[model samples]
Target: AQTVTQSQPEMSVQEAETVTLSCTYDTSESDYYLFWYKQPPSRQMILVIRQEAYKQQNATENRFSVNFQKAAKSFSLKISDSQLGDAAMYFCACRSGSARQLTFGSGTQLTVLP
Candidate 1:
């Protein structure tokens, strides 16, 4: 079984600043994928980034990057130069090789204060 947990239910960051959203997971599977998804007001789950368990390096896409600590089972998302468009519901998810579905966290709503 795999589970994801996001301790913070909500987070706020100033515009053009940086914010890091924390996430922790427990998975029995050795092969799995960690992901961060952003859902805006339109309710579209956009893939911010993904990190494979076998990969030593973390995954990054533009200003969205992940700090993947496999040993600690921690995967946190860092948003650099936050923008108003970045304000959304962020979800941390895990997908094991055997499962077709992804296990998601409760989610954290990010607010960008101008």
Candidate 2:
């Protein structure tokens, strides 16, 4: 079974500071996709960024970027210029092309301090 792992239970960052959340996964298949999702108090899962296994380049979206290590099955998220609005629960998700179902990590709670 493929699974995502989030080592950090909680993380804090000052306003305008940058922070990176660690994540890892266990998968035997070579074809897969990694995703980072942000769940605010509303519980809406918003996609932060995503990386394709076949792609060597890491994915970046505005202030968010990912360090995707395919061999290690590690996909870490980096948030630059963090703001108070960035406070939320971040989750790591993976899906293989075969199953086409998402396997999500427990999650990492982020608190952006003022």
At residue 55, candidate 1 shows an lDDT of 98
Provide the TM-score for each candidate, comma-separated: 0.98, 0.97
Off by over 4 Å in 2: none
Clashing pairs in 1: none
Strongest candidate by lDDT: 1
Worst 10 residues of 1 by lDDT: 41-50
The count of residue-pair clashes in candidate 2 stands at: 0
For candidate 2, write residues 26-48 as lDDT tens digits. Answer: 98888898999999988788999
Best by TM-score: 1
Q: CA lDDT of 109 in candidate 1?
A: 98
lDDT of each: 0.96, 0.94
> Against the correct fold, how does model 1 do in TM-score?
0.98
